[model samples]
Target: MKKIIILLLAVVAFSFKTKAQTFHVPENYTLKEKADYGKYEDDVIKGIDWLQDTPWPLEEQKRMETNVFLMKWIQGSPTVSIEINGSVAKMTEKNPQLLMTFMGGYTKYALQNKTAFDKNKANQAGVKAVIDKYVVETDHKNNSLLNKLTKIDKDGKLADWMTSDFNKTK
Candidate 1:
């Protein structure tokens, strides 16, 4: 009985059929044009973004443990999962006050774990593009919020995630 329930749930949770559930991520990322992510990087990025937006699957309660498996389904990259799990675990525990900060942390971790975290043309250009948009929108919001975002980069620059330059207008 337990096995059957688990099996049914496994199918439900991992179902790639967008109509089967609300787990679809059609516009998962803007990383499509970025070549460093490779030919199927767009697909992998979509899968990862899906995992990010959805509620935690009850069957896969220990997300940190299942990180490797999830990574495999998303083009077989474990590094991003490892860092995401760590960031999520930390944010869930250490600093609930920093939820927004942790949100950007996970994003940066995922992006930086890619081969393009360095000062390559793809990485540098991607960072600048993302940040410019972030600054404009953030400026309309609040500078204090922006400061908090930028401060969370204490972990690492990670090629200037949105949080890194949140203080530009400050």
Candidate 2:
């Protein structure tokens, strides 16, 4: 019985490990001209799961790339945005900093396309509400990220970049 239980546990653990490894952004992935929410649904869900379960990628380039990709995927439609927002909201206990990373992507995306982003009232409002919720729910005492988020919430913008001059560097 003990051996059988151990074997089952090992199998379950291995399956989870393999599942986590399966959903990374592909190297050839480029932002498509049009957002296809239906086509990328599974990838978006798995990517969010990975973000919630895994630590932020340590490499600067990899981190920024993943963040940008996630932002693009999640913002494909209002439905996708809601799903991603709910997942990130639940990350407050595990790693609230993920919210910062997610927002950083939004900032980068805006910088990349200022005109379109500025015109998108829905996107702007959604980002604002998320930032406000994060600031209210988390402790901001000496937490630089949370403090930054508070400012973003107030200003109705999120431009905190982990990398200096992301546009030039990339």
Best by TM-score: 2
- Runs in model 1 with CA error above 4 Å? 1-40, 57-66, 69-89, 92-170
Candidate 1 accuracy as lDDT = 0.38
- For candidate 1, lDDT tens digit of each residue in 107-135? 34456465545323332333332233234
Can you tell me which runs of candidate 2 are displaced by over 4 Å? 35-38, 53-64, 76-94, 98-170
Candidate 2: tens digits of C-alpha lDDT, residues 66-114: 5667677655544323323332344333544546544533443444454
Q: What is the C-alpha RMSD of each candidate to the true structure, in Å?
A: 14.5, 12.5
| Clashing residue pairs, backbone N/CA/C < 3 A, model 2 | none
Per-model TM values vs. the true structure: 0.27, 0.41
Index of the highest-lDDT prediction: 2
Give per-candidate clash totals: 0, 0
